[model samples]
Target: MENLDIAKFGGTSVGNFDAMTSSYKVVVGNKNSRIVVISACSGVTNLLVELASGKCSDSKINEIIEKLRDIHEQIIIHLENQHELRNYIEGHLKEIKEQTLLANKGTNDQLTDSIVSHGELMSSYLFVALFKHYGTDAQWFDVRSVMRTDSKFSCAKPICEEIKVLAHDKLLPLINDKTIIITQGFIGSNTLGETTTLGRGGSDYTAALLGEALGVATISIWTDVAGVFTTDPRVVKTAKPIPELTYIEAAEMANFGAKVLHPSTMIPAVRQEIPIFVGSSKEPEKGGTWVRPVTKSEPNFRALALRKNQTLIVLSSPVMVGATGFLANVFSVFAKYNHSIDLVSTSEISIAVTIDAGTTTSGKAEISENMLNELRQFCHVKVETGLPLIAIIGNRMSENSGVITKAFDAINKFSVRMICYGASRHNLCFLLKDGDTTEALNELHKQLLED
Candidate 1:
């Protein structure tokens, strides 16, 4: 399958009957797209998350299950084989409700993984049924069969070599022009065959991983947006879709919260040098951005990304003023807690780092109070909330003084808490009060991207 291509549709792309129908048409229209990765329906995963949290009352859980049932029921009703698929969907939903009740008995990541996975599981089944209804031969393949990962429960790490072997043995022979393989993304299994997830937005990463394993020529990411934009259109109405971006630019944008792609989604694609096409499934003919090793255009100011709910933690120790391992020690604490830091800045005797406030991508606390207590052993820890990180993605940013001037000049009126630059030429990031996000984004986009 040298000419094979993996088309991964996001939740919005396959949210309903019409959306799934449109997606299958895109698949059949492109003969090379023999493999399809799908996410949960748009609102199904959120409801599933609420159900899995186990914090809700029994009635709330039942209500959430009904809401989930209604969402899928609306789509399943449109299929010609609606009766059979409806039975299958109801069976899964019943299981979800049961598992959720059992999960509330204790805090179990394993059970949570199983509870939320039904979204993709049932959606893939419906998608296969829908695909067949459209005269296209499609088989629903369990991604866990090939998508092997460590049993990390909520946020599993893929065992790359194992997945490659599994894909070759289980997936390669079945994939052909005669039939398309439909599979769920973000959900995988471990050595013991327990269900696991790759955190939120892992569907995009799944597509890239499969693309690399199959050595596909191209990976297409279909979403609600036409392409990667200068900024979120919701935040700035004038935000425009970017036509092309180098892999570095795309990776930076994703890492800094562009939301169009998962941060880790770019890794396998970059390693394999596979080109990725991101477009709107609703309007595939209008075209979208192409992310490659190099793009024809390399602007100094390409786009802006705003990451909300950031907590700024400043560790102050006079020893850090002239110490060597101070930064390493601080990072080791974060490593122990398994929390990732987005941006950091250091002064003469203090270092401040920004971590996502509230819960992480896996639906767990970003940083625990105990972690903070441990840091207090050697330094004074000051924590500030309600700060959002804004990233300016571009090329030669460090080398271009004028570009940096224009960027800061735009948002200089805002009280910038912490700034991180000179480390990555592709991005310049800073922390701002949550309240300043809209106005700051507007000012930055207007000056940097629009001007």
Candidate 2:
């Protein structure tokens, strides 16, 4: 099949009726826009997550369900097909309430996926109705039908070969120049037909995966931000929107801590070398960022990324003086616990690494004592919390003789916990106390990103 354009809108972009209408304008404006991916209306997923936690009393669950109903009702009541949409949403809300009540108490990953996925499901339904009301030819599409995955439940990985075939069979025939297919993001089905989610902020991943599966010409992501910025705008109010970046730069930015796109979002787009456009739905006229295989601009220092809530793990052992497999053994323990290490630096006797200190989808501390016990069996372990990882992302950073000096000079006053350089040309990563993030970003942005 020929390549088509795909568009995915984030939560805030479709937060309510007005937001959806703004995104709808972006959709109809682009004739090539064949598939429109929607996330749950802003704040809905959190409520669903709370409901699915099974910590709530019957009344609390009822209350959450009612809030969800009200959130959608406000938007539905504005729809021309209010009566039909209300009944449709009410049925799904009822199912959610039933599932939440019956789930084995405590956080069940499988049940969580099943329940939380309704956010996207209901939003897509409402979006379809809204589009129809605006006189656009749109149909609701179940992404799970084509987005087949393994049964990992809360954080499922897609089976790419299966997805390609499924997309051709299920999605190709239905999408055309005039027809707009509205679909859910972040949720998919496993081979056993159980609902699975691609983790939080997976909507971008969903759009990229579909674009890769269907050979899309370009993938447009409409979010609250104008585009990828020099640094987080909140951290540095002067942070400017980046007009263009190479795929590598963008991927590094996402992986390091840019919230605009999911880290995994770059994988599919990279695989197919598909270009992605990110812009704000509210101010579409202001333009956005374009990520391509290669861009005309290539600056040594492109952007700074700050990933918060990082825990620094330091493993010390006398056996590591000249050990060949010590690194492998340490990583093996992380793999056993299904945890990923972000940045690492080593000395003859110790290895220091940074990892996310956030809770797992299962609602447990990611760095559990059990995993620490295993590490302790081999080496002394010291863990530090409240450290955030900062990444200086750029192009040919290693080749830029003065980049490091200039970067460090910018934030020289701050205490640096760990630094990981020479690993990738794209970034220089380090950790700092959480309190220093905003100031560090400000200094770094002024030095590296600004003229």
Candidate 3:
């Protein structure tokens, strides 16, 4: 069987028609049967969101509409077979604009869905049209028709079994024909037939999910960056790209705070043991990061990722020093909020949990009020904000005695509040003051990479 390569282009790659045409050429250069997943043109999603929420003025909406029209027009002008494709895009854009305007006045879920969905709809149409203009055997596939989801608006969960059935029955036929299919990522339809978006940065997830369903050999996420870095270069000057990583390490780094790939995007790919690549759309020739199962390469520290604005909630119960399930009940409240626990440290008298301090500007005292009230029933809960959690991720760190020592020596000046290593020892998460995050990351990266 020929290896199937599924490539997903992010918003930056499809930000404009020139970029779209460039990416198309890159795909053609691969000279292989592949499916391309595309995100909406840049800024369109944000504009749509603002318009749908009635947060922007009519002038702003009109400006966005004009921009969208101009981008499509430019692409059409450059196409060899321009007339038909141009008309199709114009018609679609007009319809999208009208619907967007109509949906602007209301805050209904349907309106939000209609407005936010145009990004992918427009991009999918443009991608297919561009590919056809280049004389490739390309066809546009509407993701909503095949990617089944629940009725949740902002963060809909995929119905995998339903999706698998639909993929086999509806999508596989085109694959067999060797047709290059272009589909929008991040948008799907619920059972009730309402348009729903997968949460933020969901395009990568869409590509992985589709790759898994198709049982593809490889999934390539083509983004602006060359590959995943040892640490965010913006924070650590010496941070370098990691050539490869195990799926477990990549997932842990992503979950801890690596922005290259979404944490949940790896689930399907890992389940199938599919090789995933993170490469540059511009520099396709350059080898990028490869994520797969364990290889002969011994486990080494692959990357450091830091999630900021962390709040540490400490629950101390003098009365429950020897009690069982005391921590379970406290964790239940966090599960209810869907807040991810980044790090945890516990003792006989107290339990400390670290969570992301989402957008709330409230000081630690105010932020802990609800949790403290709940804890007041059995213990004293104290909250500390303005902190950050730095995660050191590696598959072999458990056997490397010097790893933790080196990390501490690197950032010795920073005030670390707590440390929690996962049961599997794949990750070491430490809490530091928010202001010290950058310094700690720089020091750690230098220590790991320089010598």
Candidate 4:
């Protein structure tokens, strides 16, 4: 209940006319000052990436382009007095088509960003049209002008000081003037005026950043789900919604594959203690999950998170025993490739680490041949694919005897891989076969979250 509230809709939430209609009601139907941030239509970003690959045949790219055109045209046909919005779409799509064709000739990160950023651009303006159709005064703006970022391209970091200035100077005035500002999320610009992205699932980060800059206490993320669940409801039918969580729990769950919020989404919001709500766009009346700092004590256990397609690498060497700078040398190789480890365990003779099997550019599985070859210079490295990680996320895990006992006992039927604890009191991580992931998650959810 702040003066100005920020609402961000994900791909699924704004994927179609029905979805956008729900969002339009949420934004325009409200009396408060609302800034709406939107993602691409559900499937647009993926197809756009294909078109940008430069490897796709002309016919294939043309097919994707036609699909994009059709999706927008379908929605526009339903609107009244949309000449301006339709004209904007026609001109913008033509430009984007040209950019997509030229994208393959550029650097990897830059090229990928150029194509993927179009998703948010298309959705934001389309939502503006939806709001207008409902007889609301709505205007859409370019976030690139306000969300100033560094030149990291796909994974660019926001220069907060610069963004603070731009957002406050340019956006605040328009917002206060009673203009419901709709802007694209997941994209920004570097100081050099190049289009950049905040990585996938960044719209959450976008809202958090803007909410923090506007000095608001909360940002609402409208998604397909009712709220953050104790477990993925699809996986465990008995799973129920969790109403509130500390900022730490939400971030930990996201990091461990609670897909409701992006893992880094908490960074901006946490800096100023801004509460974030994860709610349903389809049914706004149903309460959602709130992530913020709270005064009252919470349960010792919060939720169970499972991440599939994980790869574990174990490096063994006697040299690691009583060795100085040994771990540093091992990490240096990964740093050279810009690869990050997800979970790590080490002993006197060996070190084990887990990383996502998905490629950095797309969420598809990829084997990192180059990284493995480099590690051969030091120790005998063993790699295992098809591993899934299960993390029990909560607070003060070491003292929570009941939940810990129940978790292990519940998953006792399934085989467990590397178990890591104490790295953070907030999490207990273990690796298992990808096949056993679902069953293990269900049983653990039954005890830790459901009970």
lDDT agreement of model 2 with the native: 0.88
| Candidate 2 residue spans exceeding 4 A from truth | 1-3, 102-104, 357-365
Error of 1 at 135 (Å): 1.3
Question: lDDT tens digits, residues 1-451, model 1?
Answer: 6678999999998899999988988898898999999999998888888778778798898788888888899887778877788899889988998888886887477888888889999899989989888888899999999999997778889998989999999999998879999999989999999999988889999999988887889999999889888999998999998898899999998888888898888899998999999999989988899999998889998999888778889999988877798888889999998778877888999988888642333454446899999999999999888778899998998786688888889888998888899888889897886675888889889888885
Q: Once superposed on the true structure, which residue ranges of model 1 sit more than 4 Å away at CA?
A: 357-364
Candidate lDDT (C-alpha), each: 0.87, 0.88, 0.77, 0.81
- Candidate numbers, best TM-score first, in rank order: 1, 2, 4, 3
lDDT for each residue of candidate 3 in 346-393, tens digit (9 for 90 to 100): 887888987764311111122435655766787787877878888888
Instruction: Identify the leading candidate in terms of TM-score.
Output: 1
State the TM-score for model 3: 0.85
Q: Quote model 1's TM-score.
A: 0.97
Candidate 3 residue-pair clash tally: 0
Give the distance in Å from residue 304's predicted Cα in candidate 2 to where it truly belongs: 1.2
Clashing pairs in 1: none
Q: How far is candidate 2 from the true structure (C-alpha RMSD, Å)?
A: 1.8
> Between candidates 2 and 4, which one is better according to lDDT?
2
